[model samples]
Target: MAAYQDTFTSIPLSELATLAQSKKDEGARFINIHAATVADGFVLTYTFTSNETVTDNCQVHVTADDVVPAISPLFLAAFVFENEVHDLFGINIEGIAVDFKGDFYQISIETPMAVPTKPEHATAVNTKYGATVPVKQRKGEEQ
Candidate 1:
């Protein structure tokens, strides 16, 4: 079996929507949208299937305050993935066909997954008897 060549590119946040539209016009189908929070900013990867044989992936780096334009205008199915990225990563995505406003998952915490979560920062658990118990830290765990 032949391996597929994946084309990866990083574009500016300002060009996200336009680039997506161009790729869509080139007959690419939206596959998925993913994001990760870094010390400097957030990194987003948008994957597309140009055909059965080729996949194209684009990455965009933006600060936490940048408002990323939604590609749902070009790909309707993108709204779901875009919303998931917004809800979890806390990066603002504007112009979504169906915006969830960050309430898609009914999560109690806001952007809990945006910043790096430390094991030592886990929430305290309360016993059934009304006693509060701290989370047990494993040995060699970073403080």
Candidate 2:
């Protein structure tokens, strides 16, 4: 048993991507990257694991501005992880699928979107984006 453990570190997404590229250039594969946001900042995890065991690992937690925009068009899973981060932590990611709020949630009491009805994003984040059905004005001489 060891009394010390490896620590997590946070770096910008752009930097992380560059590092990944460099690693690939050096013939490393089987990489995984995950990002998380916390009360004080965010977390970025990078790993090159094989045989279901982590041999090379790195984790970084950083302040809001310290993150890198996940270049998700390269990796499909990055897109999903980013969505979960934005939905739960409000961390903004550029070029995200929709870059809005409110997913397929039930709008229940436990949901964060209804907290104050943010007149701006409430409409776009829903899975039903731009899905307004026609409604008619009724009961007037002008109608």
Candidate 3:
């Protein structure tokens, strides 16, 4: 078996479409695009695979106001991931082959994965039972 090799490269947002086109010309399959919220903005990762063992990723960092170009023109299936990232992370992706216009998901919360700028929404606490449970009922506090 060939050793699996994965590589990540950071690129400017403007070059995303070019990178995708280059990868397609190289006979690589578009794997997927992933988005994550960062302290100041968001990071988008575009992944591609070749030879079933080699994976290449292109990462871009953009602020909420940055407009990202869609790669769906090169990879038709990229529309799904682009719409998802736009709907969930609120990234402005333009020129999607199949634009969903934010209707891709029937979610009530807009940009739920976006970074919270308000102080109230910045803190999160998770309890085993629930936040409503009295402190005395916790496992360590149980008598």
Residue 94, candidate 3: Cα error in Å is 0.6
Q: Assess candidate 3 and give its lDDT.
A: 0.78
lDDT of 3 by residue, 1-143 (tens): 69999999999888887888888898889999989766556789999997778888889988777899999988999999999999988889999999999999998867766535433223321111122312223356424
Cα lDDT for residue 127, candidate 2: 24
* Per-candidate alpha-carbon RMSD to the true structure: 7.1, 13.7, 7.6
lDDT digits (tens) for residues 10-125 of candidate 1: 99988887898798889888888988766566789999987656778899987766789999988998999888988876778999889988878787756656534433222211
- Candidate 2 segments exceeding 4 Å error: 1-14, 23-39, 50-55, 65-67, 97-143
Clashes of each: 0, 6, 0
* Top of the candidates by TM-score: 3
Which clashing pairs does model 1 show? none
Query: Considering summed lDDT, which 10 consecutive residues are worst modelled in model 3?
Result: 125-134
Error of 2 at 76 (Å): 1.2
Residue 6 shift from truth in candidate 3, angstroms? 1.6
Best by lDDT: 3
Candidate 1 yields a Cα-based lDDT of 0.75
